[model samples]
Target: MEMTSRTKKFTYYRRKATNVIMLSSSFFSAIITIIPLFLVFYYTVREGLRYLNIDFFTKLPTPIGEPGGGMVNAIVGTLILIGIGGGIGIPVGMLSGIYLSEFGKNKFGTLVRFLADVLSGIPSIVVGVVAYTLVVLPMKHFSALAGGVALAILMIPTITRTTEEMINLVPHSYREAALALGIPKWKTILFIVLKTAWKGIATGVLLGLARAAGETAPLLFTALGNRFWSTNIFRPIASLTVFIYEYSKAPFKDWNEQAWTAALVLIMLISIVSLVFRLITRSKY
Candidate 1:
């Protein structure tokens, strides 16, 4: 009886130890992931605080050694790129996702899925090259429109995958219920399935936008960069990432400071967008 009791005690201790180890590992993993974010935020704010001002948002980028310049042009260009990219990306992504989830049981669906996976893995620089060839080269000039196309390509795969996953999570019972109520399959999917998965879809779209906003390589050859403010989509436009890249390459102190400031701004913008997406996904709507 003592031996049996000892065996039971040993088994209990083993299980307890396993649970403790698993919990500790998970906690450590989370901390590891968060450490880089904390460091980035700390350093960015430390370096950028001095340059944070209303003038920073209103003035144009100056010559390499000049002071008092800002990223107003870059900010505007980033906004325009995001707007155009999102406008093209969202509809195409959503429809492709719907097709993948609703009608993708065949060979065609498999091919599309494979293509999306391949596209996602392709380097951003490659997308830029393709865009340059198809858009910028064809037009004989770098433009915000070409940059938008490059970003749209990056956005599409992310949006498509997330949307498909979200729609798949909707219960089959919802579809059956709609069908029993005399709703057609297409109508049911349009109203019921999409409504149920709206939050997840929005989350994906926001994440895609965040990803696109920080892309530098894709915009490097596509949008290039403008020295002055440009409203023309057909001409090279300044972007925060491109601004940071260009300024950081120079040896000038003022330009370097501006680069750090631009980096900080981009980080903040992405963080805000991600936080908003999280909040939206958590809400009932």
Candidate 2:
């Protein structure tokens, strides 16, 4: 009996020690992860605030050697590019996702899944090269359309996989219930499964948007960066990422400061996108 009691005490103490060690590890791991993010944000705000002003939002970028300018054109162009990307990406991604979740259990589906995973791993620069060949070359010029196409390709795999996972999370019982009510399979999927998983799908879309918004390589090959304001989808366009890249490398102090401000603005734009999507996707209940 004494031996058994000592054994029990030994086991208890060991478990307690393991738990404490794990908890400490997790605490330190989280602190390490968050510290870098905090430092980047703090530094960005410190440098960016020096040049941030009303003119930065309302006026056009000035010529080299000029004193002051804003990135209003780049801001507008970024929005338009995102809009174009979303228009092309959302429908194709959602449909592919639905098909994969519902009917992708066979060998063909396996092939498609493999392809998506491969596509997701491809470098953005490679996608830009492909887009340049497919759209820019045929059109005989770099254009916003080519950039939009590049962004859409980058967005597809993320949106498609996120959608498939979200849809699969819906209980099979929900589908059974809908079918038992004499509902058509198409209608049931469209109204029931889709509505239930919309929030998760929206998150995937937001992630894709954020990634596309920050991409410079793809836009460099496809859009080519414009100096003047132009909204034509067939024309080269400016964007925040390209502006930041160019300004950060300039010899002028003012342009370098504007780079910091542009970086901060890009962060703000991404945050705003996240917020708008969150509100739109909020639970109706």
Candidate 3:
């Protein structure tokens, strides 16, 4: 009887020690992740805050050696490029995802998933090179269309994978219930399964867009860059990323300040998009 009590006590103490160790490890792991994030944020705000003003958003960028300028054209061009890319990518990605989740239990589906994974892993600069050859060579000029195409390619795999996972999370019973109610398979999938998973899919789409919006390498090869205002899809246009890259390297202190400010704007835009999508994905209705 005494031995049994001692054994029980020994087991309890051993479990308690393991739990304490695990808790301490997890606590430090979280701190390690969080500290760097705050440090970056703090550094960016400190450098960028001084240059963020009303004029920064409304006026066009000034010439080298000029006193005043803004990223108005770059901001507009970025929006236009993102819009074109999202328009092209979202539908195709969603359709591919639906097929993969609903009917991709065969060899063909396996091949498609493999290809998507491969495409996702390819360097963005390589994609930019491909787009430059395909789009710029044919068009004979750098253009926003090429930039849009590059961004779309980058977005597709992310959207496709996120969508497939979200759709699969919907219980099979939902599909079975719809079919039992005399609904056709197509209608059932379109109405029930799709509607149920739409919120999560939207989150994925937004995340993909956010990622595309921040890419610089692809735009460099495809859209190139314009310093002045440009709205045409067939013309080279200013991009926030390119502007930051150029300005941050200049000999002038003012241009360097502009780079930090542009970085802040890009960071805020990404943060907002991510937070919005996270909220949309988490909400239950």
Candidate 4:
């Protein structure tokens, strides 16, 4: 009887010790994950603060040898590229996703999902080459349109998979309820299913845009980068990623500072997009 009591107490303490060790390890793991993110933010702000100003956002890049300039054109070009890319990619991706979630239990759906996965894993440089061949070659110019096409291709797989997953998350009960209201299948999907899933879908789109914003290799072969201010989609345009790559590699001190500032700007842009999406998703319906 004493031996049984001793065994029970030992087992209780053993389980407690195991739980404590597990909890401690998980807590440390989280800290390890978060510390690097904080460090990167700290370094980027420290290194980039001196160069960030109204002029940096407003002026064009000065000549290479000259010191005082800004990345105004690059900022504008980045926005335009994302706009065009999102416009082209979002609709197609959503349509594909809707089909996959709602009507794709077959072999064709599996093939499409597999293809999307493969496309997402392909190197950004490879996408650039494909875009250059399809858009730049046909247009006979390295244009913002070509850059957008590359980014669009990169964005598509993300949006499609997110949309499919989010749509599936909408409980089948919701579908049944809507269908019982005498709604047609297509109408139920468009009005009920899509509206319910819009927030998650938007988050996926924003995440894709954020990922595309920092890509440089695709722009290298496709848009090919511009030196001057250019808003024309048909003409080559500058990008923040490309500008940062060029500036950071240059021997000039000022250009290097500008590169850090561009990195900060890119991070801020992505943060703002994520914040906006969060706000929209949580807003009162």
Model 1, which residues run further than 4 Å from truth?
1-34
lDDT of each candidate versus the true structure: 0.91, 0.92, 0.90, 0.92
Residue 111, candidate 1: C-alpha displacement in angstroms: 2.4
Error of 2 at 111 (Å): 2.3
Instruction: Write out the backbone clash pairs for model 3.
Output: none
Error of 4 at 255 (Å): 0.1
Candidates 1 and 4, the one with greater TM-score: 4
Off-target runs (Cα >4 Å) in candidate 3 are: 1-30, 277-284
Q: Could you tell me how far off, in angstroms, the CA of residue 211 lies in candidate 1 after the best superposition?
A: 0.3
For candidate 1, report its TM-score. Answer: 0.87
- Which whole-number lDDT from 0 to 100 does residue 157 have in model 3? 93
lDDT of 4 by residue, 57-83 (tens): 989999878877788999999999999
Cand. 4 Cα-lDDT: 0.92
lDDT of 2 by residue, 86-128 (tens): 8898888889999999999899878887898899999999999
1 versus 2: better TM-score goes to: 2
1-285 per-residue lDDT for model 3 (tens digits): 999999999999999999999999999999999999999889879999978998989999888899778999998888888888899889889989999999998999989988988999999989899989989999999999999999999989988888898999999999999999999999998999989999889888988898888889999979998989999999998888988998988999999999989989999888987887777677765
TM-score of each: 0.87, 0.89, 0.88, 0.89
Q: List ranges where model 4 is wrong by over 4 Å.
A: 1-35
Range of the 10 consecutive residues with the lowest summed lDDT in candidate 3: 276-285
